[model samples]
Target: MRTAEEIRRVVRTAVEAAVWAPSVHNTQPWSFSITGDEVGIHADVDRRLQFQDPAGREMLISVGAAVFNLTLALATLGYDPLVHLLPDPDRPALLATVRLGGPVTPDEHTKMLHGQIERRRTHRGAFVDVMIPRNFADALSAEAQAEGVRLTPVRSESGKRVLAALTRAAQEVQAYDRAFSLEVLRWARPPGTTRGDGVPADAYPLRPDHTEPDFAQRDYSRDHLWGYDRLPSATRPSAPGLVAVMSTVGDTREEWLRAGEALQRVLLFASAHGVRAAFHTQALELYHLREFIRQEMLEGEYPQMIMRLGVTAEDAGTLRRPLSEVIEEDA
Candidate 1:
């Protein structure tokens, strides 16, 4: 049992942790509302990427990741989070509602993940010449499975090449398309910016490091000078790292949310072991390309995220909106 003020404090802490979850272009498309002991997670539709993510799949996924973080924060604070996904019929934007109940000892694993909520960053360049252990890989897959998502590591050389080629093709097309380019540029921050809601210039290298298989990265810098000064070590072409795809059985809103939860959980698990992930999601944005991946690569499973995971010496920083900008009070 807990008092009203204690519950309010816990909810506040949870929202603070929730905003740190990664979003497409750091859109942070989520808002929180506290009503006594319950917390409501809402998707901020205005912040959604209209051109790139018209279906709101990515936006919902981002909200779901926040929900996962909120749950972990509650658990770290010694409470059981009772969750209801898409709870209200009249309010479709309401993604989830969490109510903390009962005090219990925080598990070691829960604490480990909670500790990494603010530390993990999305790696953009090549990874070090090291392989993630089999045990850790297995654990990551299991963690996704627990949330009804599948994390399949693309291990074969041919598979890697196919994914890389598709990524390159998508990147080329998106770069040349004016609308796509403008949309991406909108979220890419110039260097020395004070804005805390977009992908920062420091988040990626000035020049893209061409990995062996050459999975292309998003051109956040565009044409102007807007990235970190290249380090010889950081820019050296290296292994493509462990390529993986996150998939779900269905492509519904519910499945997308679950995929996001799985992704955040897996990311936290990998970060706990000093591993980081770089996303190559442009191909997944195209309908035909995504279907090809679903049929050829994922055995007909709907692909949600395509990523490469490995260890990195470079520690990049990410940005998030403050709670004041994202949270609302109940009227």
Candidate 2:
């Protein structure tokens, strides 16, 4: 094991990288507490969307993604991360506690993913015509399976259309509800604002290209006209390269965390292959829609994340609170 000071340094670095994990609407709904050589992950419930995510399930899943990022960071640094999910039941807010364990060498692929940890963003536009290599997709599916989750890629055009229509239904439901609209608007930042959290105006295109299935994106703008302008040079709206879902058998809290770990594994692997992912989780937010998808579509598996995968040349950025704001010291 590394010395206390060295462990502290590694933990700090890992938390720094873990902040890049995607959350619903860029809410960044998580915080970290550094206690000696270990770090405790907590859901920043203050950042949760009460109207849209009142149950805290999505918040937990997002924090689980952050935990996955922490493990990846530790692995790349040659320290096996020892993690305990939801360690204190009394303290429901505490998501996980991770610390340095035995030293283990990280492989080339892990290092590659670690490199893109910060640069990867949740894309909000259509993908170019480029095709995602099949081998990479298979490997990502394997990664998800390793975490007890299934990453199913929609193969048929009919399946793609069905998923797209479901997304449309969910988006329409969210759009008409004032409460849901307010929740989204709360996180969509206007241009020129320098907030360190929330979805930036430039995070997605102003006029997103409609793919064949016509997947609907979250209405972050809320019709107030707050977002980046579309570039004039852009011609056609690109295709939806890959439509996929992450699912598991159970709906327990632990399963949610596992789903999140699987999600990060898939996303980082996709990022390594230069593929960006756009999330259409509006369907998953509503209980009936989620239950319907699980029963009719997923064949008894619980849906965690619904996304479209593809390639893009965009240089979108992400933000997180400083360690000072998130990290709580034992003292």
User: lDDT of each prediction vs. the true structure?
Assistant: 0.89, 0.84
lDDT of 2 by residue, 43-151 (tens): 9889888988888778888888899999999999998999999899999888899988888999997898788778777888788888877777788789899888999
RMSD of each: 1.3, 1.5
lDDT of 1 by residue, 244-278 (tens): 99999999999999999999999998999899999
* TM-score per candidate: 0.97, 0.95
Count clashes in each candidate, considering only residues at least 3 apart in sequence or on different chains.
0, 0
With candidate 1 superimposed using the best TM-score fit, by how many Å does residue 109's alpha carbon deviate from the native?
Answer: 0.7
- Runs of candidate 2 with Cα error greater than 4 angstroms are none
